[model samples]
Target chain A: MDAMVEQGPEGSFVLGKVDDLLNLARKNSLWYMLFGTACCAIELMQTGGPRSDADRFGMVFRATPRQSDTLILAGTITYKMASRIRLLYEQMAEPKYVIAMGSCANTGGLFQESYAVVNGGDLFLPVDVYIPGCPPRSESLIEGLMLIQQKIEKEPWLKKAWTNTKNPKDPQIEGLL
Target chain B: MTSEALIDYVKGLLGDKTKWADPEAGDNFLTVASEDWKNICQTLATDKKCSLTYLRNFTGTDYPEDDEIELTAHTFSYSEKHGLIIKTRISREAAVCDTLSKIWPAAIWYEREIFDLLGVSFNNHPDLRRILMPEDWVGHPLRKDYKQQETYRGIPTTRPA
Candidate 1:
């Protein structure tokens, strides 16, 4: 439990479990990789812009996958781009999250019948959240980010590693390998 | 000169090599034998009157019933402010045509696109590789009788239906 043991004019120190503190830090600063392939990218940019201001929640865009803790797929996934997506995902650090934004990334949407487009990102990626819209509004994208925050708060990162438990969302990874 | 005059000029230059198609509404085009395609395009590009210096568009169409594939090139001249459409039909069983990239460098990627989607081979093209599809992609997706593959590199190409 985290509690203030004493009060002072300068500041008060609080005691808490390392896991809670770590989760708190992680949930607040989710640096998402700047990756978008289609129209949903516009919405993503707007969400990061002043109007929606994703920065208010400590979410910011990172230029490289190596520095990002989250990936927001903001458009269609073509067969030619599938391997490239996998390569980027593999380059990210551990405890990474994936948000499949817009209808195209969710189920290939209107392009489901296309000869070259992949049906959905989940067919190859272990997506953590799905935002539904032809191109989801910025508000919904923020809500999706909050959902990821909630997920991060609940994860017992150290305990899971000690227990040797695997994430349930990794079946697609198994098939890919 | 207008497109009509340009077409007539091209007809005069290519003579026996060109077979003029009846102008449909405002669209005017001529069909040339596959063997004479390169020489005719050379003439149209170099000839003083028909200086077709710009290749506006290059594409192909499959005619399954006719057992042939038609390759179309739309050429325009900035100096003359005129354009003409030249087409050539090749046997479907062996869909090959001479590359016009030598005359119009813009035809390089256009030819690659046609080759990628329509399965038309451009003989002697500098770099005739798939431009839109992956290297290992099975069949031409735009062919009339093309069958979508079940999977591409282990990813399902079709959705659950």
Candidate 2:
């Protein structure tokens, strides 16, 4: 019955549940970039392995950021690597999501005191989800990914919560800016 | 040859150049004045008896309290089947050294890394740039007196903990 919807100029008025259908499709197929720089990468790979296969959620790894909708930062981000991270985020298509996987990418972990490491990826990127662990287990990462899917389903298209025009109002985010 | 004989041979070649020698130390370590560093290194590399042809590692140490920086090079010889250590102490005020990259091509990256982390300048290096740190980074972070910057390019660097 949904397939019988009119394809003419008045298609918008004919399709009442278009937003719900679009959100469902977008939430399912999230192509993530396979760009990990440290130990957290091991856990990320395990998430894609047989036991906790990410393919079950329609998640797959993409080599290039341009084709991917999600960026899974699965390791330590150093001062030298922050520019490259920002560049990759820019290359990704619109309506993208960032998942800070592990304590290193979320907040520098054991290397917090070091002079070279970046404190957190949120300082440079608009992170949508954070998975906390020195190196979060595969189960934990999958849980975080599910949370992102939920957030995607909840977002409104016309009055989107994310905006590039201004930084977030949160003090921590503002301080980073 | 044994480590003792190798140290003795290097010490003899360094003759007046040897500032300090530690034959009984844990490792065959010795220190030389910066002025004679190049000449001693050249002899160790070219001379058949003291053939320290393979450059294993080259690095620097910071001594802020004494206002000095020490650069050390570890080399081994396949022909002689032995190793030698050559180190030089330079004042922090003028931390410059003759480049060994010409002698050992591998020293190129090592020299650049030392310069990047310890602020030691290498004269006549082919291409000297930061190896581990960002190009525009302000100070040598490995230096004992280094203070971590609060921010970088508007990004807060301090940890939230």
Candidate 3:
């Protein structure tokens, strides 16, 4: 409730500032690592530029995966690059989110035929939200981000992510599925 | 030379070597023997009056039922102002075509797409690799006999209904 210093399950410092929780969510300003690997990457860029100005949604683009809060896997993920991407996902700090943004990142798009593509980013890492489009129009990405933020706000679980220790008893993971 | 005169001139050059694929109009379609595709492409590109400079597109269409693959090489000459669609076919069992990469650099991407989507082999394409699908993807998707796919790894895929 107060500024109590709590050591989270991951052994990281967590400030249990209940009152500041809402403010924290508002100010955290999600930083997205633009993983524009294909045509969809083009639309993702539009979201951040003058047109959609995803920046308006408090989503700033970052080049470094280590410094980002969100990973926008915006294009196709080939099998060759899958391992590197997984490593990048692991490098992000705790409480990180992933946004799978496009047909290729979601379902391999039209390239599902080739022997090279990994089909989708989901094959490598868990995705928090999916914004579907051949390349979802930039508007859709903004909408998807808003929906993710809204879900985060409504779920007390998101705020208590650190407090709720993952149960080892559950052998498998549960998800939006 | 306008599009009509250029096309008329090309008609004379091919004599009996070509077929009127779409004389019904709306779309122009001409069929060239698979063996002569290279010579025709080179002639179109360097012919004195027909200097077709633009390689509009090159693509393949698959027919699983017939076990054949058809390719289209759309070329146009700016000076002559003509657009010619030279098409040919190859059996699915032998999906290899002579590479036009040396003649038109842009053919490289199209040839790669054919290789990626249709699994067609361009005998001499410098980098004959999958440009569309993942480098390790198992099967060609556009083929009519495409297999049912599920998740790539543990992640469930959104299947096309």
Q: Give the number of the best model, judged by DockQ.
A: 1
DockQ agreement of candidate 2 with the native complex: 0.37
State the lDDT at A36 in candidate 3. Answer: 76
On DockQ, the stronger of 2 and 3 is 2
Q: In order, what DockQ does each candidate have?
A: 0.52, 0.37, 0.21
Writing each residue's lDDT as its tens digit, candidate 1 over A24-58 gives 99999999999999999999999999999999999
lDDT of 2: 0.83
Give the per-residue lDDT digits (tens) of candidate 2, residues B51-153: 8889999999999889999998999999889988889999997889999988889999999999999999999999989989877788997789888778776
Per-residue lDDT, model 1, residue B11, is: 69
Ranking by TM-score: 1, 2, 3
For A28-55, candidate 3 gives per-residue lDDT tens digits of 4877886777888888888899978888
Ranking by DockQ: 1, 2, 3
- The alpha-carbon deviation from the true structure for residue A19 of candidate 3, after best TM-score superposition, in angstroms, is 9.2
Using lDDT as the measure, name the better of candidate 1 and candidate 2: 1
lDDT of 2 at B138: 88
lDDT of 1 by residue, B81-145 (tens): 99888999999888889999999999999999999999999999999999999888899988899
Model 1's TM-score against the true structure: 0.91
What is the TM-score of each predicted model, taking all chains together? Answer: 0.91, 0.87, 0.69
What are the candidates' interface root-mean-square deviations? Answer: 3.2, 4.6, 7.1
lDDT of 3 by residue, B1-161 (tens): 76567668889987888787656657677788889988888887888887877899899999877888999988887766678888998999878889998889999999999998889998878999988665656788778787745555433344334
